[model samples]
Target: MTERHNAFFTDIAEATRLTQAGRLGEATALIQRSLGGANLSAEGARPTDASPAPHGTPRLEGPATRLDPEVDAAQATLIPERLRENIDHVMQGLRSLVPSLNGLTGGGQQAPGPNGTEPDGVASEGGQFVERSFSNAAGARDYKLFIPSPRSGPRPLLVMLHGCSQSPEDFAAGTRMNTLAEEEGVYVAYPRQTSRANAQKCWNWFEPGDQGREMGEAGIVAGLVRAICAEHSIDRSRIYIAGLSAGGAAAANIARAYPDLFAGLGVHSGLAAGCARDLSSALSAMRVGAPGAAEPGGAAGFGAGAVTQKLRVPTIVFHGEGDGTVHPRNADAVLAQAGIEALTPRQEGGINGRHSYTRTRYADDAGRIQVEAWSVQGAGHAWCGGSSAGSYTDPNGPDASRAMLDFFLSHSLTGGQG
Candidate 1:
């Protein structure tokens, strides 16, 4: 068979010779017919040995699969040696375009598990950064997972949803929340919303249609939470949710629906429930600039009326009193809608300036749950302690990262059947 295959090409070369030597017409007909025959015969021949068939015997065949010849050639010929080098070069070029991935300074790899004992190549723990995709009733979504080093037992999980126009990497860089995760020895997960849904990539929290139990945006966020809990050492009693702006609104929706999954929620310059019925309402609610804008509903059952469930999770609110977009008053309305009253104010100073806080504690039939509002004077609608490199962020506001961690650690969740 190998000989026959070689002979086929050999005959084509001879045909070329004939054409080159003035037998043009004959070479042309023979070339076309012979090429057709070779293709037909090649289909049934083994790749290892391209043999021809004997008389009265059909050629032996293997399963036929479609493939792209160029792709196959590239993988077979070009990819192996060049893949790593090309990736490095491309990543270097991308650093200029997307600088956040390169800005994170601290991440180290732990010692590999003694001699491949664990499966999935549990090599050294590198920064606790991991990612995967999952599908639910709605669709498939990508989720970034971060687990703290030295996992002794089940640890609390914190889900951080990024704000509008921010990716997982951007959020990680701006918040520097990974530093908190490493200190607390807890896992952190960030679920990214696609730009296709909203151009700004904001979570659709204003519409009642999206605030239900694991349905739309809330469902996708919860799906990532469930996936992380399944894959890592997660503490069910201490699961928490937090986000900024649009993400904060989405976090509220998640907490409202799956109170069992999250022990508390941390919101920054965000809208409360029932204020938005759609995108327009959501934008309006965020930009109204009125103090106490959070008190449930101004539009009759819009978001003013608190749900009977009492938003079982403890809450921490961060809003700049001088914010022009979402006013500090909206923070009041949010507290009112959640049925929490402000507590005494305390002051603290550190990286930026001294911050004042007002806390409210709520209790259901179970026990006591806390809700606090941190109103920073002169701050805008930006991340309180975000880095200066990013837009719409303030490095001088109160340190929300530390505050959220402390509040989340203090609370406990009730149910996990979901």
Candidate 2:
């Protein structure tokens, strides 16, 4: 009963069946073959040198599937009218959103998947993933905490924020940051963004209400971090925050808001804090660098002399040169916003094989490294040196987890700032 007309639908159904049956590797290949995508991992990465993004959830970009006019009309109700648009228009909008909608659709991930991944950080690799929550005057947020093996003294804390549409589990699997925590005796916390806040589960870094030091999302996140520090005996001087995409953008803003709280910062494919004030400007910033920023989200967005007056913190940045979702110029904008432009950087080229990159490092008057940036060659809006088990990861080269953690630990909060 194999009908020639039903081949495509049949293949799709079989792929779904395989995915549900936990044959992720095979299901991914079939979906790619059926959809005419390149040989790619479940995370839209190549298993080898071809892969080069991290923590950025895979997008649903593909050749438009044309249907009969009657079929199109019949399926119009499948999507809400307000959300309906031509493929090009929808793709353009999605690009600006810097979305990670893969989990919502349930296409590929598996339970008890590779690297011992599980929902809510359960079934992890030799560490405990505990669920926790924090509420403040601003709002409430739930988070997952990764506790390393028993240690004698205080441990360093790393606050990790996930990209749009990604959860703590997905981000952990992608970046393998928790693995680093286990190996290095560090505590990791993942703050969740509720859908009630943003439809995409994106951090509201661009919103004026959320950017304040003691208001909105920034306050709530900082409160949570402080609570964790007290509860887990975290080293205040060693605390750091990092995020991918919107989370990265949020990290930048949070660091500025609470300069004395975090000692180091990491932004991966993210925009600078204060890059935009609302959705419109956020979209523009994500597309092209913020031209009106006065100094890449500094003087204009915050105020005159706001950044220069603040204490400096050590920071490390990672961005793919080919990131289409978030303009690569945003990276330069981030450095400028951090005031690294005032210091001359010693540039190094071609570190690590396959997905070669150029690294820039800057030091201060004391000869201490203050800032580092990685410009990944031919990479895109994803986490670098991540595992393929999670969404938005590219298993290429130049491990971001190692590089970021090393950078964070090397600098401690001395006199309330790095």
Point to the candidate with the largest TM-score: 2
lDDT of 1 by residue, 45-90 (tens): 1122122223233111111221111111222232234443443343
Off by over 4 Å in 2: 1-125, 292-311, 351-353, 415-418
TM-score of each: 0.63, 0.69
Worst 10 residues of 2 by lDDT: 62-71
Q: Judged by lDDT against the true structure, how good is candidate 2?
A: 0.70
TM-score of 2: 0.69
- In model 2, pairs of residues that clash are 53-383, 53-394, 54-382, 54-383, 56-392
lDDT of 1: 0.59
Question: What lDDT score is found at residue 321 in candidate 2?
Answer: 91
Each prediction's Cα lDDT score?
0.59, 0.70
